[model samples]
Every structure is written in structure tokens, then in C-alpha cells.
Target: MRDPAANNGRELARSPREPPSVNCRLEGDPTPMQVAKRYRDATPESDRLPAKKARLLSTNTQQLGTENETQTKKTTLQQPEPRRSKRSYASFLDDFADEALVHRRPELLCTFVSEWLESVESDREKHCRSDSHLHPSDEQPVARLRTRSAPVMVKARDIGGFTVPPTPSSTGPPSFRADLDDDRSRSSSSSTANVRNPRYRQNNLRFNCIHVRHATSPLPVTLSGHVDSLRAQRSSPGLSSDDLNQAMYRIDVLAEGCDEEQVVKLLDDTVFPDPEGDDTFGPATGLMSNSSTLMAQHLVPADGASPYRVTQPKPDRLYGYSERTVGGAFTQSQLLAQTMLHDRNPDYTTATSRGLRFPFLAIQFKAVGGTRGDLWVAANQCAAASSACLNAVHQLNISLQACQSTRRVDNLSYCIAVDNKLAELYISWREDSSNYYLQQVDTFVLSRPVEFQSFRTQVRNILDWGKDARLTQIGDALDVILEENRKNAAQAAKSRTSPPDDPAASAKRQKPSSRRNSKGSQSSQTQICATNPTLPEAEAG
Candidate 1:
């Protein structure tokens, strides 16, 4: 040995590092020895890393191929094709290795990369050309300049229609190193870029029909019966008009002004008294000064206070006790129809959208049909005075109850009848508070009728027929029709002015008439002017 380390160092210093030796540059059909020598001289240490990586990748590929084969056999549909073979792992690495050699040798690199790029572009173009899922015409790049992060959260969803939660403002988007994250979001966004897809039109059409009806039309309705009392366990004998006033019920006859001694004397004479004292009602004051503060208010047998049911033996003239009063209770409701909303700024669909709210709560008189106006004063009064609660919710329950009574309309888009048999007297609230709200109530169901449908159809037809429809489709159709009409009118005017004695021109002219149907065939409504076949043949004549 001749001091090897020192000799190697001297050799390295002598070469001036030769730009790290363009690693393993392939010569024209170079032999293995030449290639190996090139690799070694290119720098032994640098070669070790790539060699190790190559071994690892090769081992992984072999293992992946084996497992894939096993899986292919295990799967039925008699077995899936092995993915690793399809992947062409060895071939892929071969290309990469070839490219590295080319880079070092210049001449080879250009040819290999060009071939690879061509294959990639061809595959990509094929995919792009076949795929209609994306709307390139509408696929304008998203304006990244806008930020709606702080907008109020209404509702949003992914392409699958599943709801996604809003992201936190503080956490921010993913880290810079997150490579797949950007691609994932981009893919998700691209999939939904076609905002005018037919699905959008369908969804908008539904909302259009529903919202417009609710906003413009009235709802269906029904009322619950008073027969609930008959089936109820508790027996409330029901109230008379006077019983409705709770104020007058608890009063007792007494002196003008109440004093302390008078109150004591009344308590002693009347209700809860000493064993030796009398019970009575009299002027009260002092401790009993509170309006409801009567002491031991006495009760007598109640012939005077109880509702006089003369039937079953209250032979004695009883007085001084009271019974709780009973009042009636019931429910009522209204159901609004669905409708399309208006659109000043056109949306993705032909139909517009608007939300229907509560309808005009008016009074209808069954006996006097036209008398009831769309006023709320009388209805509100009835709503208040009737046993039924006057809230929209309570009214809804009443309508449901009323619906249960019959089987005519089940979907309940918009309808209701107010034929509550037990309803003693119905009153509707007045819309105007300036006047007293005392109007008789009638049964009126506020739903869109057939005429309403015809109106909507006519509007849609007009939109389709006229250029003023402001839609591309409708405008084109209109232009064609107008052009044809103008031509026809001009020809008709020319025919009227033609010289009367022009025999040839007259002979050439044809009269227009309605079309005729042939045997077992439907006739076309329109007809072209043609000469009659019934005319005598010139030679025969």
C-alpha cells in the first residue's frame, strides 16, 4: 500500500472536480463495462443513493405485483385484473432511467421526453373531448378576487347535495406544503361549475311554482267541531252570556263604605267563623282593604248563585254558593298555495320564484255571498271571541281538524271550508280599526282556481310567442313567425292591386282555403294555395 488516502486526495485535487462528471452518459450502444466505468467515475458516493432508491422501488414493485395478482384471483367476476401489471412499474422506471441518461448525454433526452409528452397529451385530449360534464361555455374561471367569507350562513351543499359546514375564519386554508389539498378543492369546484345544468332548472321550477302561489294566492282551511265536549271526561255545563263576565260574579250586598269593624262583623256573621259566631257578607276595610281581601266570605245554599236547573229537586230556596262558569273552545286554520316568484334579474331558469306568506284573512257570508269583503276586522273579532285561539298556528290545527272530517282534497295545496256545524255565531275581524269590527263570517276557501291556471298558461304562451319575452329561445321563434307574416301580408296586398285583365297572371294565381281531412287521417290546420284537381282537363274539353 502506498498511503492510499493521501493518493486519492491528490488525485481528486488534480482533476479540479470536473463539474461532478455528467453521471453515466450513454455512448452509442455502449458496452456494460463502459457504462459501469462511467457511473463509477461520475462519483462513487453520488451513485450509491440512486442505486439504493432503485433497489427499494424495485422491491416494492415486485411485492405490489404479487399482492395484486393474489387479489385478482380472490375477487370474483372471476377475479379482477392485477393493477400493478396495468401500472407497468418496471416500464415506468425504465423510462425515468432512460431520461436521466439522456439528460447527461443531450441527444437522447429530447426524443424520449417528446414521445412521453405526446402520449400524455393524446390521452388528456381524448378525455376532454368526450366529457360533457363540464360546461366550457359557462366555465369561466372563478373570480378569486371576491371574498364572501363573512356573509351570513344560509345553507350550502356539495355537488352530491350533502351539506358542508362553514370553515372557521381563524384557522385559514391548508399549509403551503399540502399538495393534494389544492387539487381536491379545485376538482370539487370544477364539478359544480355548470350552474345552469338541467338540475338547476328543475329545482328552480319547483321553487318558482311554490313561492309564487304562496305570495299571491290564498290558502286552504278547515275548522274543528264543538262536539269535543261530548266526548271529554270533564263535564263543563257551558256558559250563558252573563256568565262570561267574571267581574259581577263575586259581589255581595253590603253597606256603602267599608270600615275595619264592619269587615270583622261580616266575617263573624258569614263564612269560616267562631263556633259561636254567625257567618255573613258586609262592609270590609282595614286588613280586608285589598280588592280580593274579604275575610271568611260566607256561602249559603246557592239557589241564587247556581244556574237554575229546575229538573232534579232543589225544593229548598238555597242561596250564597257559586259554581265555576264554563266557556266553549275550538280551532281554525288556513293553508296557502305554492307559486312562482318574480325575477327582475333573470335567474338560471325560465320560471321565476317568490315565497308565499299568509293570505288575505277575510270574512265570507254564506247566506249573503257578496256582502263579505276582504276585511279582517270582523274575522279578528270572531277569532278573539270564539273559543278557538286566534294565532296562525291555532288556525292551522283547526284547518287540519276540518280536513279530517271529509276526504275530498288530501295534498292540501290550497283549500278550506268553514262549515263548523256547532259554531253558534261566526264573526270575522275587520281590516279597518277606524270602524267597529262586527261582520258576520262566511265560509271561503282561498285557493287558486282553474281560471287562475288558464291565466298563468296564457302568460307563459304569450312569453313564448312574443319577442318581448326577453329570452334567446322565445325571441328566435318570434322573429321567424313575424318574418313569415310580413311576407304573406305583402303578397296579399300585391295580389289585390294586380291588373284585372292579365289572364296569364290570373291563371297562375291560386285561392287559399282551409285544409280538408282525408279518410282516416287528421287534417293539417294550415294549407298552401294550389290549383283544384276538379277543373276539366284542357285536352278533354
Candidate 2:
């Protein structure tokens, strides 16, 4: 305290411009030590927004990456797996069994197995090494032993006295040596082996024999009393020819095989019974007598002993109306055997046929009833006509070539539907193309109570159109098709034989044209010079 202010003033005077020390403090401000203590105390409480935001962003980025990876994994799982090749061989066998089952012939399985085994053996033989220890002669004894058990072997011995020879000494075991004869004997044995080893030939012959026997066997006649029953039905009072025609159509549609009596009985029981009325065609003796009398008059031949043949009935005569005339007797199938369709058994198995061939034409008469009837039913009739037409075309194509001469075979089909008041005729034929397609040629309608004469005229017009117009059109179309095919074949052959285009040759050809064009331009310039003498020489050039 001895003069302290004066001492501080003396220190300041000594260094007037000297800066203050870092730890020095102003009068009103806190001291440097106090500020440092304050900063240290508040450090833990300071905001850290940037760091927090960075952490949140990093976590979101990681979550997005994980989600992307999960999405990629899900996409991979959604795809269908590729097919394996190992199952193809099993599928082929399954297909083979299915096809064999379709034929209803289990023997086909044996045939397929035999063929497969033969093919496998052939392939094995082809791939086998020639120098291998397995000698071809070693397998002969097994084959010979197999063939000797066959029934054909007995027949072969009786026919040719063919016998299997012993194995050559070279191929036999070392202990069992056999002497060889002349070369002729070896040649004879080789030839015999070649001829006798093919056991399939014998099997084929046996199969053919069975097929021939089955085909030639006559179908049993089951319509012994069919005529009698039909006659009985015809004599029923109030029954018209239309009813009779309907009955015949029903019979034709339902009958299968030669069982006409059964068909008639079924029709009587199911279709023809008049449920609404008491008067029905049931099995009655009185009706049979009347039917027999009617049968003797019309259906039966003049000679009662001759077998009755079914014929189309003549049109009924109307009072005060003249009779209509039609040309040619129209024949319809009254029995299954007479129809053009293939015969089938009750099981739907196709019956074997003899060599006899039926005609190509098939006609069905359908009766329309009520007001418009079903449009779908009418459409089906068209389809039926088309099918019949195509079947005829196929048969013709197989049996005969297109008539090279003027005798054109008209393959047309017709389905006629008639009601009490209206009649419709549908005509169909095959159109020309790479494949035959059915086409409706025309549809004709006639008012009900139509005269037979008008019907005949319309039919004759259709026949004429088919014979003259349609046939000629088809032939012309066929000719055009054949010509186009010939042209295509020629073009194909020319393309196959022609040389490839050469760029150098094409350039050479272009050069000549370019020279000619230059010459043409030069001539034109000279002509201009002659016409305009005052023109400059450079301009003319």
C-alpha cells in the first residue's frame, strides 16, 4: 500500500503501447479464467443438429438399400421354373401307350415293343466295335433257338426243309471244333438266315389273314319281320305319307347294323307312340292283318314270293289338283346296310367291310314343324349336308382321279326339309383350294302343299347346275391351281439352279448404261449448237 497507484502508473509509462496479455480482462468484462470456465460448463448443452440429421439420413439410406435387396429377391422368386429335359423320355412313353390304347388293340403294344427292340439291337450292332470279343456268330444260336419255337418254323421246314446250321469252328469254343464244308454250304446258310430271321413277315401275314376273314364275313340279317311291322304301321287310319316319311327318316337316323326289327320296335316304343291319343301303333293282331293286306298291295313285289324292297312312296293326290310328275325314282336308306355312312356296332366300333363300295350320294329328309322351328337345328342341317359333301369328295379323291375327260363326277350333297306348308332344300359342295372346304351352293324354298312337278323341276335345275356350271367351275379352278403349283415349282427350281448375283458384274452392267447416257448428252449438245448458231461454244459443250 506504499504508493501502489504511482507504481502501476510508472509501469504503464514504461511500456505505453504494449498490448494486453491473453489472460488480461477489461474492467466490466469477466476475467479470461472465468470465460474459460463458463464455456467448459455449457459445452454438453450445445445443439448438434447437423450430426443428428446425418445419423438419420444414414439410417434411412441403409433401410432403402435393404428394401431394394428384398424387392430384388421377391422378383427373383416370382419367375416360373424352367422345364427339365429328363422327363421327356417318360412323356414319350406315356404318349406311345395312350396312342396304342386308342386303337383298342393290345397286340399293337407287342408290335411296338418288338419294333423298338429290333431298332435298339440294330443300333447296338452299328455302334459295336468290329474287333470286340463278342462275335456276331455267337448271337445266331439264341436267335435260331427263338425262331425254332415259332409255329411258322414247322411250316418253313415242310416248305423248304430250312435248318439252322452249327456255328463255325473259328467262332466256337476252343474245345469244340467243327469242320467246314465247301463255300456253297456257307453261302446257302447265310441266305437262309437272311430269309428266316425276319419273323415280322410271318406276323404280318397272320394279321392280314385275320383281317381278310373278318372283312369277308357276312353281317347277320336281323330284319326278318321289319317289312311286316312297317306294313302294319302304314295301314293305321289317319296316317299320311308325311307321317310315313317321318317314320322312315327316324328309322334311317337311329338304325345301326342289320337289326331293322329292333329299330322298328324301338321307334314304336319311344318315338312314334301317340301319348296324347288312345289310337296308338301298339302290338295288336287286328292291326297286323290290315298291315299284311296293305303290304301285299304296294310294298311287296308283284310276285309275293320275292323279298320286299323298300321304295319311296308316290306323292298323295289332292282333290281338284292335278298330279305332279318327277323324274327318276329317289331312293333313301331304309336299312343300315343300305346307307352310305360307315357301319358301327352297338359299342361304336367300326364294322369291317367287304370289297363292295357304295355310291357317293347321301340324302336325308328332315321334316320341319310349327312356325320357325329352331334356327340352330336348321344350321345343323347345313353342317350335316356339308359333312356329307366332304365325305363324298374324300371318297372320290381316294377312289378316282379327277376326270381327265368330259365325264365330270358331280360330288354334291342335299338335305331337304319339308313341312305341311313349306319345303327347304340345302345344297353343299367342296370349294377349290389347297384343301377342300365345304361351301353352300344354294338354298331353295317351296311353299307348303307344293306339287311334285315343281319340286322335280327345282331339283333338276340343281342337278343341271352341279353337272354343267359347278363341275366346270371346279375343273377350271383346279386347272388354275395346278398351273399355279407348276409355276411355283418352276420358280423354285430356277432359283435353286440360278447363280448368285455378283456385285462386280452389276457394276460392269451399270458402266455401259452410264456411257450410253454420256453419249446421249453429247448428241443433245451438238443438236443444240446446230439449232442455235449464236450460242457460246462453252455453253453448247
Candidate 3:
């Protein structure tokens, strides 16, 4: 009898004595025998199928086992490789722990500054320009006059000068108070009484004089009357109208003595002062000096020699305008520059004759409240300071070149915002351009709890970090971490969008018999079986 497995065409082996080869062509559904015949035909003669039935059977079993093992190996090789673990901020900090410690050391500040200076010097050629044109100067003269109804008389003695006395009211200018009847009556009565009484001699009359010290000069002088009266009395008897006008213009009247009306008229007619060609006559020097002093106080030791120094021809005093309008024209920081940096001289124009030192660091500090308005003001102040530093550095560089100095001066400017809860530090430098401009290097925000001790420590740490290279490293590390997080989020989103393939699930779906029937179908089948229990037996009969 034929083997059932052979009839079903499942066995690949046959008697070796019957045939070593069989038809390779497939009919209907190909059998294992047919598949074996194809494999035998494709192989080399030395590797041909075995002739003996037992040997063929053993060979087929070995070949099938080898094929299964190769398929397993292929599937394993095609599997995806595992991804590398992402780094965390904590691990990054640990890697550079020693460098962080080095950066925090106070002793390294000098080294950092030296390195920064060297870098500036190396890049000097890029910023240094051949153009010698000065910045377009903006000079706003402060208005010093105060309005008053009555004309105030400043004695000549107060201003440190002598002037001719008034001619006993007879030949004086019109009285300031025209509506006063007493003055008119006195003038008429005195004239008549003086003429009637021959004992009253004009030449022997004694005059009252007031002595006052001058604002600018230390010397004192005596004045007989009002400056206008003195000037009227001093006019020549034969002088023409034009000549008298010229003489009045030449007369040096103290600013304090000028009437409100006269002051307003002068201001309306007077032209603004021309821009000072040299730095000597303008307010720039004073402003620069004040700015420098503020910087030195915060950045350097009191006795230590700083790499940068602020200079004005007269560092001893602020510019005239600065002194006159201290609080009005400038901010508290600017006023501090004027008053704290130099001696409080009433004379605004008085200053040290010495010129500014080269390579100075300019600093400006602004106090900001938590209010939005204060923040806006602080921002503007910083911007203005940046512009000033750029201009100053450009001028200094040009001056150095003009003097043929070997030292290359680079202007470094800093703007600091001080607040109880927050602090900001900004670094800026001049850009190489025909017009003066400043470029901001960086802004550091130091945030912490508003405790004084901790806040102060935080500020110091931020400053130190800025000076060292660690700040840049930390920034880079943060950027990398953020990028990795973003990539991870994207991969998660992609995975959520596409469902994973399941081979077992697909096979179960294709073969209905492998899946369990729904509840409704199962209930219906049970009911039919209960109602017709003998149906299967009747069909069998």
C-alpha cells in the first residue's frame, strides 16, 4: 500500500533504485517532490541528489533544517538597531564640573580681562577706520533764566567788577515800577527841594554801596546801584544813539542782575553757541568724566590702577550746562557723575586742564523699579549709554592714530540695571563704520529670590560667569538639550500617527474559524441546537 504522506504529496523522498531524477515541471499545486526535483536540477553534478532512498531522505531532512536556520538568521539581521540614550543637563554639568569651579575663582578675573584685551587688540584692524570725521555733535544749551515781575538788582561787587555809580537818580534809566506814585512824587519833590536848599550839594552827597562776592571769582567788589542805572550814568554826553547802544552791549552785566523781560528778549534774539571744534569748549569732556568715575567706582578697587580711565580736560568740574541743569537735563546716574566724581564747584565751567586717559571703560548704571515705565526708561538709558561709548571709543581710536601712539585703544562699555528683585548686565562695543554705532555683545539676566545675601551672590556669580568662558559653554549645552527634546517630541508624534503592524492580528482576521463568534451569533446557534436536538440524527438516517 502507498504511504498516506506520499499520496498527499507531502514526502519529498522516493526509492533511489526507481529514479535518481523526476520531472521538474509543476502541475496545479506544486508538491514537495516537484520542488525537490527543481532543487536537484539547479545543483552541480558533484552536489546531485543521493541515489539510495534512506540517504535521500537523510539529505532532504538536513537541507530543510539548514534552510530554516538561514531564514531565522536573515530575520534577526533585518531587525532595527537600538538608539543611543539622550544626554541630560545634569550629566553635562558633571562633565565640566572642574572647569566651572575654575571659572568661579576670583583670581581668574585678571586672566580673563587680559585675554579679552588681547582679543580686542587682535581685532583692532577690522574696526579701525582711516576716516577722521568726527561724530555729528548735538549741543543743547540749558535755559537758565527765571521769570519775575520786579527787576532784581545784583550789586557789581558780587560779580567781582567795579562800575561807575548812578548820577543820584536825576540821570538814571526809567524806573522798573512805572505804576508807583511814591517814586514819581519823590523825584519831583527832591528836585524842587534840592534847588531851594543851597546847603544840599550834589558833589558832597554820600552814596550807599553794597559789597558782594562773585559766583565764579573769589574777589569782592562794591556797587553803587542797579547795573542798568550805572550803564545809563556811564554813557557819554555827546554819544549818538547807535554809539550808546554799542556801549550798552559792551557793558558786562551780571546774569543775576538781568531783568526777566531783558532775559527773555536776549534769549529770543541770541543765536545758539557754535559747535566747539576742539573738545576743550564743549560739555562732552565733563559728561565723559562723570561716566568714567561711575564705572571706576563699581568695577575697580579705589586704589588699584584700572586699565581704563575716564578723562576730561577738566575732571575737577562738570560742564557748565551739566551743573546748571543737573537733575532736569540728565538722570540720577548722570547727576551722580557730575557731583560725586568731582568737587562741588558752583562754577560749572571750572575743570581740570588735563586731557582724558586712553583705553578707558565706560559704565552707566540705571535704577529700575518693577513698573513697566521704569523698565522702558532703563532700556532707553542703556541705549543712550551704548551710543555714547561707541562715539567715545571711535574718537579715542582716531586721536591715538593721530598721535602715532603704538598702543591700540579699544572702547569697552557696560550698562547695568539695578533692581531689588532683578539685575541685568549688558556689554557693548563700537562697530567699524563711517557713522558711529555700538553693537551689544550680550545681556545676562540674574534672577533669584529677593533675599539680599542670595541676590548679591547671584549677581556676583553672573558677573564672574560673564567674564569667564563657562557662560558660552552653558549656553551651547542648553541649546543641545533643547534640540534633543524637540527631536524626541517629533518622533513620539510620528509613532502616535501610524499604527504598528501585527502579523498575528492579520492572520486571525483572514482565518474566520480561528476567531471566536460574536455574542449574538453564539446565542442564536445555542437556541437552534436546543430547538432541534435530533436534526443531526435524522439527517444521518
Which structure among the candidates has the greatest lDDT? 2
What alpha-carbon RMSD in Å does predicted model 3 have with respect to the real structure? 53.8
> lDDT score of model 2?
0.35
> Which 10-residue window of candidate 2 scores lowest in summed lDDT?
315-324
lDDT of 2 at 239: 32
Residue range 30-59, candidate 1, lDDT tens digits? 432234456657876655677767876898
Q: In terms of TM-score, which candidate is stronger, 1 or 3?
A: 3
Best by TM-score: 2
Candidate 2's C-alpha runs over 4 A off are 1-362, 366-379, 387-414, 418-423, 427-450, 504-541
Each candidate structure's TM-score, on Cα atoms with residue i matched to residue i, is 0.15, 0.21, 0.20
Question: 328-383 in candidate 2: lDDT tens per residue?
Answer: 11111111211222223211111111111111112223233333343233333333
How far out, in Å, is residue 5 in model 2? 99
Residue 124, model 2, lDDT:
48
* Candidate 3 clashing pairs, residues 3+ apart or interchain: 157-221, 314-351, 314-352
- lDDT score at residue 227, model 2, on the 0-100 scale: 14
